[model samples]
Target: MSTTDVSTNDIVGAPVATTVEDVLSRFSGGNREDLIPILQAVQNSTGHLSRESVLAVARHLNLPPSKVYGVATFYNQFRFQPLGKYHIQVCRGTACHVKGSAAVLESLKRILKVEEGQTTKDKLFSLEVVACIGACGLAPVISINGEFHAGVAPDRVAGILNVYRRRAKNG
Candidate 1:
């Protein structure tokens, strides 16, 4: 949502196997407004949008690659990089901030040994900060793979990380 442009490094490179032809075939080649659906389908197929997929879309939709990339970059929900198996989203909203969310963020960053928007070396977890999760009443919340942990303190972070680590180890 910032005016600053996201760098290509923000999007890890991975080849996309699913083509626009495949998407069009599935949709029966109706309207061009189907571009969004086409892109989403490619993303769902590849787990992330690879450079090849972008080019394929450009060719199929008769748009330039730059425009396609522009649209992809405009949306926050679309991920260019391959996400970790476990995605961790930490709330840093106003209410959370008032309740010491910074401490929780620091704890998570330390435990994961990765800065915000980076995935761990093991590819087990990716850390990200969200404005709010509407759990402000609980404040200082952390969501691991969509499961919310509220009222989290620095002390509790290690245990939570340990739980994920153990699960990873087992699997």
Candidate 2:
């Protein structure tokens, strides 16, 4: 996958590499209390925390690697793998469920060939099921990289993914 895509939220400096190191340099690098913020920063800067980044953060904080892993796993907010270029978040809240989001979710899984939280092998897409996205009125909504798709039906999943696929290829 091309990391240089214009749609990707890469850091402003056009960091070709050293994303973890670059994010790490922003912190104090020694305080125990700085762990969560450090992890958040890394995730924000790179879409998710990589294993190398987790280890790097542990080393920077002077903590055991297991400690960092434990803290990260304990929270639902942290993800160790980088997200795909197009991250799809399908809302499965009460309203969305009633509106057939389960079928929508299933269609997404089948079409993308990845379960929830898994990225496509090409790194073009990732699937996530969110509890609520504050679009209940537009129940059965899915967000692709924060752009909302409202009133989605299972049949529309392929068209939506095709649009992103075409965008990636054309870019």
Largest lDDT belongs to which candidate?
A: 2
Q: What is the alpha-carbon lDDT of model 2 when measured against the actual structure? A: 0.80
lDDT of 1 by residue, 1-171 (tens): 122122221232232455546765675554567667666776655656778888888777787899889998787546665567777888889999999999999988887898876778888887777788788888888888777888999899999988988998999
The local distance difference test score of each candidate is: 0.74, 0.80
Kindly list the per-residue Cα lDDT of model 2 for residues 82-157, writing each as its tens digit: 6888888888999999999999999999988988868899988878777887889998899987788999999999
Minimal lDDT window, size 10, model 1: 1-10
As a TM-score, model 1 comes out at 0.69
Q: What local lDDT does model 1 show for residue 112?
A: 81
